[model samples]
Target: MGMEYEKIHACSNDCLLYQNECEDLDECSVCHESWWKKVRLYGPMYLMWMYLFERYVKILKAYFKNRNRPEGCVMESYIAKEAVEFCSEYLSNAEAIGLQNKVDSDGATVIDFRKIGYKNDPFILATQVKQVFYTTDPNDLELSLVVLMKSRDIRDGEGDADDCNCIPSVSRGLTPVDEVDVFDDDDSNLVRLDVEWTYGTRSGGVNRDGIDYYNNLINELLSNGLEPFVTLFHWDLPQALQDTYGGFLSPKIVDDFKDYAELCYREFGDRVKHWIPINEPHIFTTRGYEYGSFAPGRCSPWLSPDCNGGDSATEPYLVGHNQLLVHAAAVQVYKTKYQNTQKGQIGIALNVPWVVPLSQSIADQEASNRALVFTYDWFMEPLKSGSYPAEMTTYVGERLPKFSEEQSSMLKGSFDFIGLNYYSASYAANGTCKRINPRASTDSCVVHLSERNGTTIGPKAASDWLYIYPKGIEDLLLYTRDKFNNPVVYITENGVDELNNGQLSLNDNIRVNYYADHLSFVQRAIRKGANVRGYFAWSLLDNFEWADGYTVRFGIVYVDYKDGLRRYLKDSAKWFKQFLL
Candidate 1:
């Protein structure tokens, strides 16, 4: 098709279609033949995939060379095994687990009768294989059968002399069994090839096993009657991307993030109905680029001496601009390509700390509104009306980047939903700073406080910045509903942390109370028609806390970091379990 071109010309008067028999006409031959034929290009039907295989090999080689062995072991032994087992168990319990009246290529009825179990203490899976008709929509039926039969034979030591060497040996190179001579009379020599029995076990090995882990998680959740709300990028930017182009600081990040988001939609969007493209852009831009407390730290020397070098006043705004652009790009891709087919809703998580007036004075009230404008409206205004907040333009002036008409048009209503991360609330008072330079923290002309005078708004959490204010969530929800025309919302992150004191008792009563109190407010907001849909506890387990360096625990399940990272369910976990029930 690339070699084919239509040497054709159309009449200037639009009298004829230049195609087929008219392709070779010299000029507008029908209309006095005044012009010569021009070339009409045709798109090639098939480009090529031969070159892609070589690049695919290179990708696999690089992936395995840098793969973490411990993580791989957990994935294969636990996550993958559990996924396969869940499918087997689910199908077994289903009323009808087949193609019903459909037949295989051989024109035969297919039936799934496979059983899977674990033999070893930690779980070495064994699957039972059975004969079945093949189908285009091959679920786990065939694979389970093969795995089960192979595992049974291996366990029973029933392989032929030469076939014994074909058994799978995980974590170790294949060791051939005793050699059998096949040169005897009426003997045929059979060569056994050792293989790894795992997902993506073929010639090109598994890269990005996290996909498998998440797939299993989604499958398990569905099997247990639950829906998954997946967040694609949660402030974990790749270090390599950061080194290559300073991560979110450059416009180049827009396409990269879009590609990543599209890949997530392609892979997991089938099961995940709610997609959050990026979580908490405000935190990522301010903390990582402005405060210089996070990875690839960059900030002005005046703000933090730990920073290598950066313009705090400029870089934060630049990063924030690029993040919004990237997010809008991802949302555009999802809406244009994936939303209809995948039937999924996409949104971005914005961490907004509800701002309250320090005093009943007009200045304090205005300051509180400015604080919200600088934080929430910084992103929401662009999303809602295709423009930045008027307050931001007036305060930041030239420090903030201006979006062109095209960019603003792309950003407007680029979400099917909105994810809000509300943890605590702060009182905002008119700023008194007369500093020469102002960054994001002070650009709003407001100061945030957890308390006024000697009285605090609410009890403080383990985190120094957090002060419990459950009513703030209800207020934020109601305000969002009214201001944003009642868009669907999810409380993506809302929880308190506790100190990890290395104690035997996992009695996190504070966390339990915190959840109960906050949930009561959420219920009130729901009653008032806030359009709130779902809520997520801040964390599932104790893990890294970025700059805090795991000094505090925010998980309902306690993790013993000193003891092989063992996990134990705290009282909060038990309480949460019952609450969910």
Candidate 2:
């Protein structure tokens, strides 16, 4: 009664266990026997399966209230007994049944339930009792954090109570003051703020009120001992620019973006030492232009009737090419006009999942390489070599834009650092070129998969695409070092998400372990001579996650969406605080 056990129905002939994928099966496949059989096929129940456990069988049979539905009655009674036992453990002040309580080293009560049965009872080993871990002290288990400084990014719309377009009457009325306190409490030294071009720029000129809002936010962060790592653009294109010239799809937006960067540099560059001109251009172009899943959604009508009319085969490449040019123009402006005077570093954040070959076949191995070229190297290669990757040029052909000699010269070696946002990995297999309805999404001729031969590459997180493979971080860093000639790297975004179950609990051990495991790999990469400078968790507070809305939470500090957006420090924050101390 003190231990827990599950009622797993089995085939009467012992042909199979009716569980997991077989839970719904009404018959056994091996012997073609009915699943509800009450007796063994070979012998009487007392003389066969229950010979030694005759007394236990009698106890189980006594739980049945209905002769016709014996199994269901016994199951219902057993579940009720288990529920009562579980409730009593938490509701009562007395020691849990069959659990021995002792004081741990921290003078906190610890419960040990491993000794539930008689010492010499062989049958006890067959019971389904699992070891229980109980501790009263919050600090009993300390999660180790990486030695690198912690940073977090704030998107334009996040943390602001007022309209993103309107300036708040008071500074305190806009930015969540308590959220900044959480950052301080967690010992985070850096904050990355995404500056929306639309928020600060209109057809007339720079919005003074918008600039003032950022000024107030920057001052608040500095006052709290947090350094600003400002991102000039996080896909928040000014609608005016988009409407006038189709945004990044046209080369005209390049100068406009550069002007926006210059404005940010003049206003916030002195205080915001770290600048990331763009974030995840590959994601933006593919999702926005090719798949039409993001803002300014545009794709071929054949791909999606909802698309706002775009050429999937060419628009993504055009947009991506223009984004590279835009990034280069901004970097060129910063390095020439603002960087020396402001003493700041500028870079771009690129998100890419580490790609592993699906098999040892040469074609698959080559596909993995091509996949990286198309994603990470889509921007990085041009920055490194002043040319698109050879694989891209070969596969995408004329659809992929070519940089002029002047533009290529400007793009080469444009950044002081590279901001990397890695969250997951995928298996790559070779695929034939799509002659019909070809798009940038499949231009690399590589099939990306999250699983390999029925088993996932790693344990999946709440996000369907996010598989937990900590080693991928190290692999990516080392790949960057060897492939891109070891440019200064900062992990701009890395964190796991969990479903918002509409409960208020600050215990997020999964996130704590995620950080610990990934940072350990980062440390390994650093030891192996990868030039990673810092690590920023994806977010500090739970906010509206784009298309996911408020369904998934990816923050160390929990935000109560229902109750005036109250902030609470999750366990991961405590771990970071302790480690930083």
Using TM-score as the measure, which candidate wins? Answer: 2
Give a tens-digit lDDT track for model 2, residues 350-412: 998999999999999999999999899999999998999888989988888889999999999
Tens-place lDDT digits, model 1, residues 1-581 = 12243334445442322123243665322222221111111011111111112323554345342333211221122322322343235322323212123233445322111111112211111111110111111112112112221212222233332221112221111111111100000111111011111222211223244355456646655554445555555554543355557777799878766766766677677877777777788887887678876545678998877675788888989988998898899899988998898888888889988988999999999999998988888988899998889998988889899999999999999898888888898999998754686788888889889898987888898788889898999989998998888898877678888765657567777777777777767766766887765566665456445444345777765666455345566676555444422
TM-score of candidate 2 on Cα atoms, chains taken together: 0.69
Collision pairs in model 1 = 27-35, 127-148, 128-148
* Deviating ranges (above 4 Å) for candidate 2: 1-182, 185-188
Lowest summed lDDT over 10 consecutive residues: which window, candidate 1? 177-186
Q: What is the lDDT of residue 410 in candidate 2?
A: 97
The worst-scoring run of ten residues by lDDT in candidate 2 lies at 123-132
Clashing pairs in 2: none
Summed backbone clashes in each candidate are 3, 0
* lDDT to native, each model: 0.57, 0.63
